[model samples]
Target: MKEKQFTTRAVHAGERADFSQINSVVTPIYPSVGYTFADSHELDAVLGGEQPGYVYSPRYANPTVAALETAVANLESAEAAIALPSGMAAVHLALLGAGVRAGSHVVVAADIYGATYSLVQGIFTELGATVHLVDVLDLKKIEAILAQEKVSALLVETISNPLMKVADLPKLAELAHVHHAKLLVDNTFCSPYLCNPLTFGADMVIHSATKFIGGHGDVMAGLVATSAELKAEMVRLNKLLGSSLGPFEAWLAHRGLKTLPLRMRQQCQNALHIASWLQTHPKISQVNYAFLPSHPQFELMNQLTNGKGGGAVFSFEVRGAGKPEIFALMDALELIQPATSLGDIYSLTLYPAISSHRSLTPAERHKLGIGDGLLRLSAGIEDVADIQADLAQALNKIGHGFDG
Candidate 1:
């Protein structure tokens, strides 16, 4: 229990116990909204958190969901983990757990996923939190804000959205601790397989399990891995917020997680090949995969992933392609899915300006270097050659105006 390989932990962690006495190979789903106890005293004990048992679904917890949480915690090497209905819910819970209340200060990455950007700037701000959007790479600026304000949390993505900027986790964690701010990393892009943010001193490691964790796109769930104290706080908050993941979704996510190591290895391999191919293509002006030597944070990425290749997801810019041309290319693709989500068995593509970053204004997006021609791709565990050929044909169709 003290030491296990990542792949072994992936398949075996948080399973084969607790919920069943029948030695079920898989974690069984407990769909009941409430649980029965031996007696009222036992129920009261469980309800008061004096003992470990599920009493309710929405407010308290469920066996299936708890199993998933345990697995995620084990994988991320955290004291505990909580599963939520969606990734945004996990983000919300992490913010609250980090003490992002009214009159609090929060420093967030400017280039994060669009919904996260809106949540910090919109809802958190409306609730009276002073949010500062900064370039996560600029540690000095972040430090300055943290020093000046009583910042509650410093939120950032391990790998930035639309642009594969690798965050220096250890440095950021140190800076946040120095300023008494909690470092909360959204580890969705890298997953537990590629990077364990908590190991680098992050106070909270969050995941949109719907993506890479689920790996099949059938479930919508989120998870937060942190110290047991933080998890307790989130669980208490969830009692009132009611954003916990359902048992069925939890089961689905848990099942998908069993193959995380396997799926990630192939996805990473496919992405590396595709990103390299895209970089050399005349139709691609830029490819933002962190593992590539050309990437700005290639070294940092290798340091973080131990040279596992950037990740399954990466972004690129099409040569002379605007929204219209981007649409043309996506339409021409036969194998790759022109969908919104990523980290599935099938390849997926999204136009950041229209999808993930759509909430931001054109000027705001351009300021963040998310051009209209930018496209985000999540490589699947498919044949690299087939995937490459799909992109090749798509580029050919959108070849009306090219650098060549």
Candidate 2:
């Protein structure tokens, strides 16, 4: 064979190097948009789904992303998994995969993530789908709604955001299956380390891998774990929507997932300690940690997680405090950072009224038991004493009599 020219060499210098003999401890990132095959026949076979291979990234898949999907599927005990650009994309794809479409009926938890609420109430509703937002804990109401309509999907968070309300997954799954509806559970809070929703009979398990899965808070990704049949459908839908996870982000998330058990263990311990301490504090009006006996769904949470832990995040109310006082407490904190996100290595605080549940009106928030004085704290793998000290000092700085 003749040597290539300089210009041709520039484009083909390191293209398609074979590493089949190389064994690496970690998965390497594959950034190529297009892949090559030994012959056109093999390429045709791969593209036609007759063989397991990657062709194009945006339309098909990537090696790194596929590795992450496999890992998540194994962790969640699902037959297959799919990675997405973000948590909302996972939710949207899960809904679509469950056969939600125009003229479909979707039953959603009333107090879900703010953006998710808007996604169903605004976009799905505008598309002519009927959405019924009901209390997920009220199984009777859900049964009645299912009986009254031909529902397509029932969506709920395993441990709801901001408030930390645990859903009855087993019962909900049974109800949905009996009604011929698919049940999709957001397992972001109770990660696979604590709970596997698929084992509890859920049709689909969703995760915002940007949270605990990417423990360091560096990568943004989402995941859906389900049967292979459903995964193929989601893959097809995503090919048209172009909401696939990137190779770099997939590599980062996969690395983060390796330490999920360790991170979640310490974070859960710290969260329970903080929740217990806050209950004893005079300024704290309410505490909402499922591990605590005070939580309404404590028993159900234990059954779901098998007492692994109550997760790393919980919400509490500051007595006689509104936005102004809440702001003062947040500003007073030194060790605990006041941030918008949760499930990171750094202990952080978020006010639901302005962050997680901001989309809902005050009346709607209040109706769901999310008050203006509520503050959510995500306990990191830090010392419990240090975290409580920061909260104590912050609480002491703000006076209860302050009005907003």
Any idea what lDDT model 2 has?
0.92
- Best candidate according to TM-score: 2
After TM-score superposition, the amount by which residue 240's alpha carbon in candidate 1 deviates from its true location, in angstroms, is 0.8
Question: Each candidate: what lDDT?
Answer: 0.92, 0.92
Q: Candidate 2: misplaced stretches above 4 Å? A: none
lDDT of 2 at 379: 95
What overall lDDT, based on C-alpha atoms, would model 1 receive against the true structure?
0.92
Query: How many collisions per candidate?
Result: 0, 0
Candidate 2 residue lDDT tens string, 201-230: 999999999999998889889999999999
Summing lDDT over every window of 10 consecutive residues in candidate 2, give the lowest-scoring window: 395-404
